[model samples]
Target chain A: MVIPVRTRGTTEFQGKYPEEQFQFYFRQHWIRLFMPFARMILITAIIATMGYFLVELSFASGTGSRHIVIIMILLIFAIVQLEFLIHFYNHCLYMVVVTDRRIHRIKKTLFITDDQQSIDLWVIQDIVKSQHGIIQNTLRFGSLRVEAQESLLRLHFIPQVGKKYEELMHLREKARHWYIQHQSAHPSGSAPHPTT
Target chain B: MDLVYVILVALLIIAIEWVLWHLFVSKSKGLIFPLETDESSFRVATPIRLRLFAIAHTAFLLTLICSALLFRW
Candidate 1:
């Protein structure tokens, strides 16, 4: 069964044809990464309050340096905040775009920006979905492997990927058909092959 | 001694954050103009290292608060 492509809003492609383009979907890792920070905030608050009592107990027993303990707690709070910001930024680097022509994969790192790789739908031989580990199975998120001519690239940690796999396959089929038609019409001209 | 401890803690947090960013976040996968093509497609995921650091930082913050309460002049 094919999932009908719906036009949710009229922002980016109002006049350009709504059904033609859709919003890019990120892998579940993009969303799950925030879970740790959210959990940390709740956990840290509870621990900090408990630490106050623990400090009092230590002082009464005359066993611990109250000053050192207090400083350590403050440092912990700062570290948690920094971690959230870093994780947010790191998750931002992964991107996948499905255009009318092809699928584009982009990954960004610190010092240098990598070139984009586009895989024409016509060249895609197969779509493979592999899920390993308990969390992946339970969460229903895992990697979608795409096999193409020159190489194979995996789309990782896609949440509820069972549906996404079907969706991608449908899209790939559509792209392949489109390319074939375009090639027939302009037989002399060669399609722009994506650079690796 | 207190000042030195603060600096050391800050440096440690920064160092961890830097490593995670470089290793996972910033690893180049060959897409020069991804944002230009589709800004929303490229997004930052939750950083695991950063979360760990946050837990550590919370420990430090509690220490500071306690110090202020007990040893303030």
Candidate 2:
């Protein structure tokens, strides 16, 4: 039985391996979610206002089906909450997970698309961090573009991307060192594969 | 006639919710994003709160219809 290692990545993702060590698990900045969250709040406020007016109308008229109006409001609120939940789930599910040896770009849209690409750390040739706007510059959030031998992985609007870029560079060097040591230590067989 | 109308609307709501959930929620369960640069299992766990909230929401929808039927206003 492989005892699952305790890490943020493992809890967020399922089916863990004992050997897969985590370097960094990066999620999108909450700023990216602010618009959707604000929209939900605005919707809830509108529903609440409508509900209050409806209840008042019922009280004033005395024949306006009070319980029915209340129920309708609650139903609308519940449905909107469900929509927000779906939106939040989609946001949470999109992540860029960097393990010691692998960089996994995992994205799952709200029931629309799921695209996951894994690039070996050693294969990544270039990593660039770009912040385009004043808000991003002030907030220290930016996009990271990773160029590999075959594929490119981009993480956009992530927080403190400069730090993450540094971390990736450090991890890349470690991977290179490990790869070199493994190559020399093996020279033939005997040693197991450095990493799968 | 009102009761029939409420019941029909209730059923319609349920049918629409069923289709939407199936399309937007259930279909994503089978996907497991690969990690470890190899074929390692990385599954997204469906949040339990979503299921509970869905059940409560469905109950509320039914209650909305029931209230409409009972009040007759």
TM-score of each: 0.57, 0.61
Model 1 C-alpha lDDT per residue in residues A67-103, reported as the tens digit of each score = 5665566556656665665555445555665545456
Those runs of model 2 whose alpha carbons end farther than 4 Å from true positions after fitting are A1-20, A54-75, A184-196, B1-73
Interface RMSD of each: 9.3, 9.1
| Leading candidate by DockQ | 1
Worst ten-residue run, lDDT, model 2 chain B? B36-45
Candidate 1 similarity to native, TM-score: 0.57
Which portions of model 1 miss their true places by more than 4 Å? A1-24, A29-31, A38-50, A58-64, A109-116, A189-196, B1-73
Per-residue lDDT tens digits for candidate 2, residues A1-196, read 1122344233334323445566556567768767877887898899888877787767766654776676677667657756765675576567777776788877878667778778888888999989998999998889999999889988898777777888888878877777778778887754442341
